[model samples]
Target: MVTYSRAALFILVVFGIGFAIGSTNLPGAWYAGLTKPPFNPPNWVFAPVWSVIYVLIALAGARTWERAPRGPGMLLWTAQMLFNFTWSPVFFTWHCTGIALAVIVAMLLAIIGFIAERWQADRAAAALFLPYLAWVAFATLLNAGIFLLN
Candidate 1:
């Protein structure tokens, strides 16, 4: 069983790092200048959505860690996090929409992989990732839109 301290640590590390990266790589003039898709959400929408998703992600990670620390599920979780962290820097900082699109796509795949890898062994952990998968799928479309429009 995962202790509360372990779960709290996972949540803190995951959300804290994601928040820091987001704070650091904000969309400024460059992003403002880009032609966004009609489906693109307002800037304010991202924070709340991501905040919820990050908690879900952390919970899933903690569950995965407790069940299969060195298994494929954990690997996929780590990959998704890396890809997740890379997206803002690639899109906002480097200003590479095309590369960011690719990054987001990879992230989406990693999310799916994590779900599949954990579904049988830990259905709860896999279920926890469903929202992340959905959001990233939408984000992938948004990224593709931005890349194509620009």
Candidate 2:
């Protein structure tokens, strides 16, 4: 079983890195200038939603890492995290929404693969990633819609 304190620390680190990455290029004029889709969430909604999602993702990562200790599943998890980290820089910082969509899609695929790979080692690990997959899938569509609308 994974230690709760260690798991909590892992969550904090992951979310901190993610939050830091996201903090650099906020929804400034560049974002305001874009043609957002009707379904695009209001500016106020993202923080709460992403805060929850990041915690879930961190839990998934920490649990999987503890269970498998850098196995193929962890590799996929790392891939997903990389893709996760890349999107904000591409979209918000570089203003490359199209490329961000691609990154999100890749993240979605990586999460799916991670789910499959982790399932064998720990069902809880696989289960933990489910929400991350779902959110990314939704974000993929949102990204696509943004790219299309813009």
Candidate 3:
């Protein structure tokens, strides 16, 4: 039986992986060259918000994994996670905002599907994903704004 503490630790590890991937040799200089939208948040805001969201995402995934180890739900979770990890490299390092935006849309769809499946297995897991979905929806708008402005 997985204790709540163990699950929490697993979530933290997942969040750390995401944070490390996002933080490594980020292209801050490259970002200055792009024409961001007028409403773009400052650079600092992104790290904190994403950190919290990633933790939530990890928790949601862990909950689902506990309930259903291998299934369509897990596959969708993995697909979205892969997409999530790739977005930083595409946007921050490669400066491919347009491509990243497209990938993010795909990621959003995968998460929606994952949540739909998880809703049946564990409603808390599905609910845990709501903030992530909301943030991604906001991010999609932001990405579109950046693409248009830049």
Candidate 4:
């Protein structure tokens, strides 16, 4: 059985990875340069929401890893995480909202596949990804809107 400390560490690591990726000085300054949709969320909301999602993602990954250490499901999870990590830099730092939208769309599809695969291994793992998936779907639409508005 995986100890609570390991699980906590896993979550912290995932959150840290997200923080590191988003920590680029360019994002905060560059974000101000972009034209955002009126519906765009306040800047402060992103960190908190993403923080929760990252924790969920890490927990799901730990659970899935415990069940199926070397499986396609884990690969999909990793792929989605890679996509997640890349989007912030692309959109916020590089100001490539269109390309970021494309990346997120692909990411949403990959996460769906991950959920489907994880469903067979651990239902809780699959369930845990639901909020992340939903958030990404909303994010994809937001990305598209931002691209259009800007």
lDDT of 1 by residue, 16-57 (tens): 999899999999999999999999999999999999999889
Whole-model lDDT for model 1 versus the true structure?
Answer: 0.93
Q: Candidate 4: minimum summed lDDT over ten consecutive residues — where? A: 24-33
Best by lDDT: 1
State the lDDT at 61 in candidate 3. 72
Tens digits of per-residue lDDT for model 3, 31-108: 777787777788788778888777777777777677677878778888999998888888888878899899999999
List model 4 lDDT by residue over 1-150, tens digit each. Answer: 545876798798898888888886246756777777777788788889988898889988888677777888888888999899889888877788889998999899989999999887688888989999988998898899889877
Off by over 4 Å in 2: none
| Candidate 3 lDDT score relative to the true structure | 0.82
Specify the highest-TM-score model's number.
Answer: 1
TM-score of 1: 0.98
Query: What C-alpha lDDT values do all the predictions have?
Result: 0.93, 0.85, 0.82, 0.85
Q: How do all the candidates rank in terms of TM-score, highest first?
A: 1, 2, 4, 3
- lDDT at 61, model 4: 84
Evaluate model 2: give its TM-score. 0.93
Error of 3 at 128 (Å): 0.5
The clash tally of candidate 4 reads 0
Q: After superposition, how far is residue 16 of candidate 3 from its true place, in Å?
A: 2.6
Give the count of colliding residue pairs in each prediction: 0, 0, 0, 0
